[model samples]
Target: MIAARKSLDGLSAGLMLILCACWGMQQVAIKIAAPGVGTILQTGVRSLIAALLVAALMLLRGTAFFGRDATLWPGVAAGLLFALEFLCVAVGLNHTTASHMVVFLYTAPIFTVLGLHWLVPGEHLRLGQWLGILIAFGGIGLAFSAGFEEHGSTSTLIGDGLGILAGVLWAATTILIRRSSLSEAAPTKTLLYQLGVSALVVLPLAAAMGQFGAVSMTPVIWASMVFQSVVVTFASYLAWFWILRRYLASRVSVFSFLTPLFGVGFGVLLLNETVGVRFATGAALVLGGIVLVNVKRSPQPVPV
Candidate 1:
């Protein structure tokens, strides 16, 4: 049996930070490797690699693959959404800065909350949550406006829009999982559906898009592939689920806000992308709004 979960501790906090950093660095990895391996093909290949690992793990654990859980269709839909999300990531990176991609993608929570409010009972938006939605969208508008500035280009704006669409798709996947039979399935099972299906879908799509011809495997490309497949996609996801099983998910999730910050930092440091003050302010608002929307009200502890 699983042990009872506890409040966040120092070790868990530290690990969460590490996980966030790893996730934040994923776009940077993709961008770095894109020159050698076309972005879409690279993403598809990594998904394939990670799917194999997940399948092996499931096999070792004796997890049933063809269970009659009535989740197959939903699982496939989730996988499609997952594929489309990364497709946007792969293509969008070609047009936008990694910093922008990270910020826009993390907006998934906002969209998820909105979706749940309509679909799930008792998931009504609170006043603060509404305010947060307003602020977050306002920030998105402000950030998008940066495209109109002299330094911004049409491609960057398109990439930003794709980033937002990716976030929306991500949110749709989350909602489907929560509302479908997949909610009761094992985490590994859910992951397999996503990874396996994404691999199947994305690889062919990449080929159709003629992205496979750019495969020049340098050490950097190989390293990026290994990191994306092993560390970011495989290990970090498992670690996150492990953390959720052991700690208060609410407390742990709050730390995710740091991911965009880390992404922005990595972009500036590694890619030398410049962030104007307008974009910075917009990002801050988006982060603040996300925190406001997600942070739940907890009753204070009474004196003994």
Candidate 2:
């Protein structure tokens, strides 16, 4: 657990950046691994592993998953929303290119900032912060708009709509976590509920969709699953919840614009995707917006 601090302190900023990077890399990894393991099923498989890991951690920490004190309604809500977010992305990608998915999925922060500001106390974004959000999102759009223009035929309105729905579900997830009783529970236990529910719900749906594709049973695949289970789901999510609790959700949400930039960076390195001047210029605007938004609140001068 992290010590108490003001919103978006140095540690919090560093942690958010790292998590954004992991999520960025994860987009590439899941795309590469999706076909063989099955897109939605792969999420379930790693979710199950992450659930087991969280369950074990819960036992050690004495955070019960099934005791009378369990937060049933909130946990279930979060899990379903979590499941829906990924399901939408997986299914949406079938109808759209990864560009559409990338652009749509990260629109989550906009929804998150709006919803949290309305619902949660101490979670409001100032006008400047809101401006930063818009600027950063615009930069993301500018950075990736080239792809949309270049391969416009590959994306469908239906697919883009589905991806937007996923972004809404993601916003719903954050709002639910903040407003629901799950917020009162330990981070690991909340994580367990989400993964357990996702494994149960998504696995059956994948089976129904005939998405249980044959596995190569390769060592590399197993390693990838292990990495997703451990790094992506377990550690990264725990860090997110911890950070969320430590800071205002709206303040934190703006920084998430970095994820797509990191995604593009890794895509260029790993997939040999070309980066044009738009990408570089957009990346600078995004980073500048992040720094602008998180600029420390001016110290109030108190006088007698």
The candidate scoring highest on TM-score is: 2
Cα lDDT tens digits, model 1, 1-304, are: 1234355667876897898789889999898998888889987898889889988998999999887899899999988999999999988989987777887887776677677667754345578867877786677557546544643778888888898899899878877876678756777778778888889988998899887876788898899899999998888877765774454443454446567767766877888866688878877886776666555554222111
Error of 2 at 248 (Å): 1.0
Kindly provide the TM-score of model 1 when superposed on the true structure, using C-alpha atoms: 0.81
Candidate 1, residue 279: how far the Cα is off, in Å: 6.7
Candidate 2: lDDT over CA atoms? 0.79
How accurate locally is residue 125 in candidate 1, as Cα lDDT from 0 to 100?
57
Q: lDDT for model 1, on a 0 to 1 scale? A: 0.76
Q: What's the C-alpha lDDT at position 5 in model 1?
A: 39
Can you give the lDDT of residue 1 in candidate 1? 19
